[model samples]
Target: MRSRIVVGVSPSLAGLQALRYAVKVARERGGTVDAVRVWLFRPLWRDTTATFERRVHLAEAELLIPHAFDAAMGGPPTGVKIEPVVLEGLTVQSLVEHAGDDADLLVVGGDRRGSHLLGSGPVTRYSVRHARCPIVVVPPPALAQRQPVDALLRELDREIR
Candidate 1:
């Protein structure tokens, strides 16, 4: 059977990396890719009525999947089958449910905000533990890691001078 690769999508750099990786693998394996994004109703979104707010959040999720594809691959990859899934629920749970047991692989972006000691963020960690399929966590490019520290050091030096 052709591989089914499910990858989580977010606005993070690592997220784009994971998406790109998933597309490449799908292309090579003659598989399909499910680019999934999960949306939740946060208590902080009290500015609008519940129903309308939920609709808006859902719409955002829909738009996000395409946006991620556009940003990652200049639009969806040419040869591979791409399915964009937007689910409303907890992030990790939604991803795991959509990926399911039969998926050949589940891919996620590592949490760059996490401390070096902790490795990945909570969602990535939870998915690795709970997901039935094998998982790959794509880390942010090294440039992403260095840019922040370099800026911070430059700022510190300026202050010292």
Candidate 2:
């Protein structure tokens, strides 16, 4: 059976790293990746203008998924299938809810700017506690870049073959 991986992404470098990691895992495991981005629309009142603003935010979030994917992987990988999902809700709750029973894995980016604690970000911490499936928290760019490029290339080659 094919694996299903869910990745939570945003515009940040860490978010890019998470998406990249998800793509790599999907390629290696012969799985499909669901790249999900969540946005919250908080309006002062329930008016037409507020509704329009919510729509705008949803559109921007939808666009951000592909933009982040392209920026991270130089366009999606050739073999792996990636489905972009834009959800309206809280970040952690949305991700956890989306990871439902079908997902084999959930991938998310850690907040490097936050305190130096494991799963420091609320989303990461909450996901660790709430996600039903296994969760992979990708380190921020600075930490991830420290790994040698040759190792990553070798892994990529292995996956392709």
Candidate 3:
């Protein structure tokens, strides 16, 4: 059972799915979920306008946590503890660094709609290859449901066998 789980969250549907999945796992495993949102702001020059834009971007990134949490788990679960973290850096790098040595699992969402390859976004792809802890990539709900229930069951049974 995972004791500490880290989840990367954004405003996308895939991010919401990852959050939802992380909450469920934490509830079942008696663990805490660390919801991390990474923001990147690159300014060509350091000026008042650039600083103002950075502030605005940071504010928006901070707001995304609560909104995504609410949309995903219907407002953070009362049964599990959630810690929201807002960090400034590249999404994949930030998440990987956050996972560090203590986290037992890192949860992220796959971009099923946009990716033509593995249906995974850049963050998910990078995390899978570089994360220190075990990673769980939750596919978008629509993509998960694309397969018929019977077919899914059969596949599960075969895996079990």
Candidate 4:
């Protein structure tokens, strides 16, 4: 009986854009929003903070998710709730698997360059293929519209030379 869209968000700017868009869409559709960010673990990795990383991740998620929820609600709270979920596993697989059975939809931000080589690469591809739910693959910004400062500097250097 839940009527909310689940958005997979991260601390990255791309993920932020997706989260913002999810709120907007939810507001228009008279629904609630759930924000989730997942961190994946590579197998056989040795790290000093591995034991403590989970706790730290949970804390960060608690702080950032609520803030995003509040920001999305805009003011005075319209009962549109934002639930933040922090999970660890295969990035996209964990997220898609953990998604509510009756969720309204699933929203995820996609990289413009299509980072299919990352650890979560296959996970992302699979989730998109078999989510069995409504999915919004937010298109990335145009490269021309977001040229890097380094590119500008290079041009200047070339001109000077």
Candidate 5:
């Protein structure tokens, strides 16, 4: 059976890279891609839990969903059907909840900028640790560049072939 890949998209490099790579893998397997965009906004408490704040925050989040969808799926890989889902909550928490059932694989992008020098910390740990399905961590496009050793090895392998 073809794999069903689930990817979480945030407004960051890590999330966007994952979406692109997920589309690529899904095409290879004749699979489907579910791109989830999470809008997390909690009203500040200090008597600011007012009705206006709640409504406006939620509205802002909802509006972002479509824009995020377009950004994530605009040039998706061919033969891979992409579906978008927008969820509101803690990004990691929502993704964990999504893992309860469905989807054979979970794909997420690695943060390109740091908690220590590079990449997102909370996101990486949360995904690799808690996801029920196998998680694929895709690094940024910059990481896609071929290393010298890797290029040499590929050349050798081609000669053997």
Candidate 6:
């Protein structure tokens, strides 16, 4: 059986980096990549529209797979097999459950921008602490630049505008 490498997928820069790195690992290991997107229903009114909300989120998740793949690698890897999975639940729980204990690896993006800690985002931190398989956190390339404080502050100011 081919080794299973599961990766969390999102549209963010870190998310795309994770997806790209997952594909690289999969190719080297001759494994299939499971690009998983977890969606949740945050209903405003309550459970009355829960079903409809789930469907909408599910559809959005399904569409995200291709878009993420495209943004990450210009398109999915040609030789490696890509399995897109969309699940309904908490992001961390859903990813861990899907990855399972037997998975060869679980890859997640390292997002620390809004995180209280400078290490990893909640998903990455949670997966590292909870996942049965080994976890790989791909840091965003922007962090390598190490922009000066003034430049970073200016960028943040622009974003707020």
Q: Give lDDT tens digits, candidate 5, residues 1-161.
A: 87788888765656677777777788888998877766666655646466677677667655654555567666445677867676778877887677545778888777555223234567677877788888887776665434557788999999999
For all candidates, the clash counts are 0, 0, 0, 0, 1, 0
Off by over 4 Å in 3: 113-119, 143-161
Worst 10 residues of 6 by lDDT: 111-120
Q: Give stretches of model 4 more than 4 Å off.
A: 41-50, 67-79, 114-124, 140-145, 159-161
Between prediction 2 and prediction 3, the one with superior TM-score is: 2
Tens-place lDDT per residue, model 4, 1-161, is: 54678888665455656677787788788787877777754535557676577567667766776665555444323546667677776666877876646677888766655544353345456667767677776534455236578988999999999
> Who wins the TM-score comparison?
1
Per-residue alpha-carbon lDDT of candidate 1 for residues 10-65, written as tens digits (9 for 90 to 100): 98889998999999999999999998999988765565587788898899989998
Better of 4 and 5 by lDDT: 5
Q: How well does model 2 score by local distance difference test?
A: 0.87
Q: How close is candidate 4 to the true structure, as a TM-score?
A: 0.71
Error of 3 at 106 (Å): 0.2
* Better candidate number, 1 or 3, judged by lDDT: 1
What's the TM-score of each model vs. the native?
0.87, 0.83, 0.82, 0.71, 0.68, 0.83
TM-score of 1: 0.87
lDDT for model 6? 0.87
The list of candidate 2 runs beyond 4 A from truth reads: 113-119, 143-161
Q: What is the C-alpha RMSD of each candidate to the true structure, in Å?
A: 3.0, 9.8, 8.3, 4.5, 9.3, 4.6
Worst 10 residues of 3 by lDDT: 112-121
Q: Name the lDDT of candidate 1.
A: 0.86
lDDT by residue (tens digit), candidate 2, 1-116: 99999999877778898899999999999999999999998898998999899989999999998799789988867899988888999998999999987899999888765434
lDDT of 3: 0.85
Over 34-71, each residue of candidate 3 has an lDDT whose tens digit, in order, gives: 99989999999999999999999999988998999888
